[model samples]
Target: MSEGASFRTYFEVEGEDRSRLGAQVGEQRRRVAARLAEIRNVVAVMSGKGGVGKSYLTAALALGLARRLTRGVGVVDADLKSPTVARLLGAAGPLALSPEGVRPALGNENIRVISTDFLLADGRPLRWREPEHERFVWRGALEAGVLREFLADVAWGPLELLVIDLPPGADGVADVAELAPSLKGAVSVTLPTDESYQSVRRAMASAQDAGIRLLGVIENMSGYRCPSCGSTEPLFPGSAGSRLAEDFGVPLLAQVPFSAGAVEVPSGLLDRFLETLA
Candidate 1:
């Protein structure tokens, strides 16, 4: 394997012998290590179910960390099919390959982002050019390979933190935990409801099963924010996030609304999470 060979290219190039494939695999692992070596912490934000604002919270966390830490922060949107972190963080367009590796786009607060969103055309869903019938057999494996490239190939600089927005499912959480051994922990995002947390619990359990620590629970859309009075009131019944945290023996780190006007950003939430990283 050449020094320039990357995980992304390993997927692109084909027809290599077994010995060469082994060296390429080793080289790709080295690339992943070199990329992660500069990153201080890796945290995966996940929800077992979708529509929980996981990506929004991921972008918020990435931007917030960049502001507070005064160091680089990067986000990897591992949600290949429906990636939105690029738009959420304002990382737009045409990513070119630098001599170092694939260059990540710049988002707000100078946050670096690598996502499949940029790879797709506008309004185009991720599609494999392979035969439809053959896809069922290899799709999962192919997606997993893409996830590897996202983790290993991008030229992410020295970052104080790297937040990964895992796709909505217990498997996505487990996949990331298995892929990145440097993972510090995982923060489960759930809505304030029994059903929501119940679904989210499977993801938390998956992370734990993969040997990743559970940082805490983030209760998104916990309440409605009164934009006029700047007050927060209950939108859902019961202390759902608290209950979820209790079940997992972890802290309920935050109860955020959907927007500030949508979900209130509580003061010191970022600060508290930072303490956990320390």
Candidate 2:
């Protein structure tokens, strides 16, 4: 046989062991469920669309919750294609692996974190808008595989809360629900515009259809806060969060004012938002 034919035949032999591959995948899923069980609460922070500071809010929520919990909080950057939790929270350390499992890196306030970013190019942190981050283009089954590995392998020990930062849309949410059915719920984040409202409504519907509870909605960048004068200003014409919440029967958890500073979420806003969960 030619080289190409020989290569194909080699893979054909491997494909014959379908049962073995299936068994291995099944066992991996079980391990993932077992690992996630140790965490007290698993909540996915998501948005119907991107560019609404969902990832930043996720990190901030983890930090806030870590302060309240004795065991500390963790964040799984489930945005497989563009993992940012590690970079955002400065948890971009080399992931340690032992016979036990993959060890998550700790960020500020003793909050543990794990992400595909840590495994990139020897754990070098990816700067925002880096060309390297754009190189990855995963689809379909590949997304599911990477997500499963994160849950099954990461050794997150005794976490009070595991906040998963999911990429925009229903696929990411569905993947988490499938792997960890015990998820506490999802906190939808969105902006204060009609455009954002429509997307968030779909997100709420998707979660409900999947039998996942919609905890609440947080309106980020709802208004601008003047740092110099401590005055609040509405950046947009109006907020649709109230109507959206009413339609879904979920509360509008908090209207986090916009910040001109580096962080997307204001300090006080994060604290008040977490209180709603209590």
Highest-scoring model, lDDT: 1
Lowest-sum lDDT 10-residue window in model 1? 258-267
lDDT of 1 by residue, 1-278 (tens): 78987565655767766568778877866777778989999999988889988988888788777787876899999999999988888888688798987888998888899888998988999999888886778999899889889878888888899999988999787777667778899888999888887888887887788878889888888788777886888888766689888988987888886454322235567877887777
Model 2: per-residue Cα lDDT over 1-278, one tens digit each? 66665345545555446558777877877888899888878889888878887888887787766776798788889876677777778776778878878888988778888887876775465333434443456445566777787787888878778889999886568679988887888888888899888898888888889888788788888788899998998987658677677888887777778875544434564555555455
Off by over 4 Å in 1: 1-23, 260-265
Candidate 1 RMSD to the correct structure:
7.8
Report the alpha-carbon TM-score of model 1 versus the true structure. 0.89
Model 2 alpha-carbon drift over 4 Å, by segment: 1-18, 121-138, 262-278
- Find the candidate with the highest TM-score and give its number: 1
Clashing pairs in 1: 257-263, 258-263, 259-262, 259-263
